[model samples]
Target: MAAIELRNIVKVFSDKRRGRDLLTLDNINLDIEANDFVCLLGPSGCGKSTLLNIIAGFEQATSGRTLVDGKQVERPGSDRGVVFQQPTLMPWLTAIDNIAFHLKLKGVAKAERYDRAMESIDLVGLRGFEHHHPSEMSGGMNQRVGIARALLMNPSVILMDEPFAALDAQTKLEMQEELVAIWQKRRSTIVFVTHSVDEALVLGNKIVVMTKRPGRIREAVNFDLPRPRDITSPEFNDAKRHILSLIREESTRLAQAS
Candidate 1:
């Protein structure tokens, strides 16, 4: 059964200055199966992030419906955990405290929160740096804290919006492997948004490609590549070629329209 579903979703923004209505997403429909790793891939301004936001209940769609676990998504909850592009941890809090912030909000005791948060810290390989503040950590470490914080919620669905886009290439690769390991062990539903085709192929079991602004689904491709995917392999290149062709064609079509 589908863990998350978006049916005939539409989002429109009023351009008050231009005295017109701008359509951002049009009739988006998607079904994300339980424990599936899906990626929303497209060029910038394609509403990929907007779709993620809608699923997270951070924004409302102008029309249609979003359902998670057979219930309507009216607002954000602990059941849906979001890791934004930026690591928005509280600078005042240490790594363990930041990971436990949600638990604290629910009035969990400090000792209990710390204990629970510590488990996640170790899961993300941050055991040695539990007391470090955001300022003292590197960008990658801070992002790890963000992931740990989200995992502490034990949410059924994890939403990531280009969470590693800001890191260096080596760091991004390391994080991707670590994330895959975590997902394999936990088996939670993940909907990740990224502009990179390679990243999508590496991380997603299913990839949904979107068109340029006034975005719509171009296609949904399923992949069953072996774990610890070799980027240099022929099968990997074949998938990459197919997706690259789709993106290139879309870009050309948009160029001609303009």
Candidate 2:
């Protein structure tokens, strides 16, 4: 069975003032196999995050099923870890504490919690900053903590919504590299939401493109480029060109319609 399954998923939001329901996701059907790093890429307002939220069980869909591990997802569960655009760490807690907070909640002993959390800390390359508060850490470091927190959970799937969007270009690139390394090491199924074509091309082995609002899947491109991909290589540029053409064509069609 697919690790994650979206069957005819649909979402509608009520615009109370406008007094009409706004269709946000028309019918999104997708299947993400285990250990797959899938990127949901599209223009802004294309329901990429909305669809991701549905899978995360943070929002209920108007119709259809969201399943993970062959079971229907009804509510947020620890089985799926989420990393938001912001780290969303506690401003006061140290990095180690924040990463192991869930364990603390489960009544795990302090020593054990720290031990488990440290493994994640190492996994995300945040070892020396264990006691640093979110405020003391750089944006990239905080993001690493967020990723560590998620990994500490040993979740079956990791859902990220533009998690690297806030960092500077250099930091963003570094974080992307670390993420791919972590994913390879852990073999976790990941569903990432983003609007940047470059980010998607750089990170995903499977890129799923969506059309504008009331989103629909445009295509699910399989990318098998070798590891440590060269962004300037012919193969990489060829794939980039293909994806760009698809987006441009869609944009042109939409513009003409408007």
Once fitted onto the true fold, the runs of candidate 1 whose alpha carbons sit more than 4 angstroms away are none
| lDDT, each prediction | 0.95, 0.94
Question: lDDT, candidate 1, residue 212?
Answer: 89
| lDDT score at residue 1, model 2, on the 0-100 scale | 92
What RMSD does each model have against the real structure?
A: 0.9, 0.8
Summarize candidate 1's per-residue lDDT along 144-221 as a digit string, tens digits: 999999999999999999999999999999999999999999999999999999999999999999998899999999
Q: Candidate 1 — which pairs collide?
A: none
Q: Show the colliding residue pairs in model 2.
A: none
Candidate 2 lDDT over residue span 75-109, tens digit each: 99889999999999989899999999899889999
lDDT of 1: 0.95
The alpha-carbon deviation from the true structure for residue 62 of candidate 2, after best TM-score superposition, in angstroms, is 0.5
Shift of residue 55 alpha carbon in model 2, Å:
0.8
